[model samples]
Target: MRAAVYRGVNDVRVETVPVPAIGPDEVLIRVAACGICGTDLKKIHTGSHSAPRIFGHETAGTIAAVGERVQGFSVGDRVMVFHHIPCGHCYYCRKKTFAQCEVYKKVGCTAGFEPSGGGFAEYVRVMDWIVRRGLVKIPDGVPFEQAAFVEPVNTCFKAVRNLALEPDETVLVIGQGPIGILLASLAAQTGAKVLTSDLFPERHRIAAEFGLRHPIDAGKEDVVAVAHAASEGRGADAVILAVGGNALIKTAMNAARPGGRVLLFAQTQHGDAVIDPADICMEEKSLIGSYSASEEIQDEGAALVFDGYRNGFDLTRLVSHRFSLEDAVAAIELASNPGPDSMKIFIEPNLAQV
Candidate 1:
């Protein structure tokens, strides 16, 4: 099998590797569609993790083989796998912070080396724990590329749900990338007026398909001013910083009302960010961070992805490029440096079937 192995910082090469063998309690999935995610790019450029690992996690495909002990699933079933599942009895699980659970931190899918997500390869072995709980069957008639969005949609949906949005509220989503569009679309579903911000006009045009009306051209217009204008002199009730890095943290904070909330969805990197303490203390604004998917909403997220396809929420339209396994390095490069027209990029191992 050909897998894109991460050798070191800023290095990824597609090389022939062994087809991972599954245990008696595990299963093997022939990869169909795997979306390139920002966290995967971050790890590749920063070398945050060790070398010789396969990193694509937004995956979906047909089961090539099932373990002897795996009952409810069969070899021919179509499914999407979550690389992490939390132990229901852990302290973090009890508090609903599943991402921090020790069991959840361990990657359960692999193509060959270290159990990092193996979706970048042709096939990935799903561990026993993931097979039991994290595996979700894709509904019939839906495309694998759409099913590949289940994991990312879960993460975005969790953030939107955490905001506790009201119908009368106004939200300013800072970024119009695929993830940013997902966040803004979900926020609009709650009846809140959504204002999308991005420097590219192409992204704003794509955002309009999801019914997002208000768009702030971050390149030419003032985001804070546009947010305030929409709210009648007050800033947005909630501002979601979907763009990566800490450069916009202060801007997001300033674009919210005195008692508004700011959700840091894409600031996954840990580092120093300059924020005014008086904003939280004197202005009563709140800074919240939502990361990863939640097990409690796993079923809901899957249902949304499945049912949404038939109900005007075709996520596949967001995919602008699809690369084969041999061209994964190029795929990663394009995803790392997105242009105005680039939306969601995918690597389809089985392009013909998917």
Candidate 2:
């Protein structure tokens, strides 16, 4: 089988490798479509982690075979793979902080080193623990490309859930990238007045099409002022920081009302960021950070993605480009180069059919 192997910094190659062998409690999936995530780009560019890993996590595929002990899932089931599932008895899980559980850090329901999730190949080995708890079956009529969105959508769902948004409240989602747009769309479903901020005019336009009431171009307009005006001078009830830049966190803080909450949905790493501690102290505002999704929320998130498609979430519009596994280099380059119009980029492992 051929897989895109990450060798070193700025290096990924489609090389022939031995197909993964399934354990007695595992299942094997024939890769269908895997989305190129921002984390993949960060890993490649920053070299924050070790190499020789397979980098994809947003995956959708069909089951090729199931281990002897795997039940309920047959050889022909369509599925979406989740890389991490928290141990139900962990301290973090006990507190409902599943993403921080010790077992949550274990990767590879299907691919790459340490089981972090290696969906960038032609096939993946779904480990026993994942088969037992995290794997989800894709319903009939759902396309593989759409199913591939479940993981990311689940992450956003976790953030929105943490926000505990009210129907009449206003939400200001900073950054209109794929994740930002997703947050806006989900917030809109909650009956919140969703406003989006982005440097690109194209993203702002896209947000408007997704039912966003107000789209602020941070490059050309004051995001704080726009958010204030949209909320009738009081500022939004909540601000969702969907972008990872250090500066956006401060912008999110300023865009919220006095007692509003700010949810940092991105920023996987710690970095120097400026914030006024007095703002939280005096104004009584709150800043919360949300990370990975949980097994409990995974099903909810998958249901949300499926329902979004059923109710016309316009998810496919988020995909601006598609690349084959053979064109992995080009895909990475495009994802790295942000223009006025780029959104989500999909990589089809089975591009021959597409």
Model 1 has how many clashing residue pairs? 0
Locate the minimum summed-lDDT window of 10 residues in model 1. Answer: 345-354
**With candidate 1 superimposed using the best TM-score fit, by how many Å does residue 2's alpha carbon deviate from the native?**
0.8
Candidate 1 accuracy as TM-score: 0.99
TM-score of each: 0.99, 0.96
Task: Say which candidate scores most in TM-score.
Answer: 1
lDDT of each: 0.94, 0.85
Task: Report the C-alpha lDDT of model 2 over 1-354, residue by residue, as the tens digit.
Answer: 878888889998888877788988999999888988888888888887687877888889999989898889999999998888888997888999987888888885646455547888888898888898888999998888889999989888888988899998999998899999998888888888888888888887877777786787788899899889888899899999988777778788898999999998878777788989987999999999988776778777888888777777747778888888888778888988968777888878778533
Residue ranges of candidate 2 with Cα displaced over 4 Å? none
**lDDT of candidate 1 over 140-218, digit per residue (tens):** 9999999999999999999999999999999999999999999999999999999999999999999999899999999
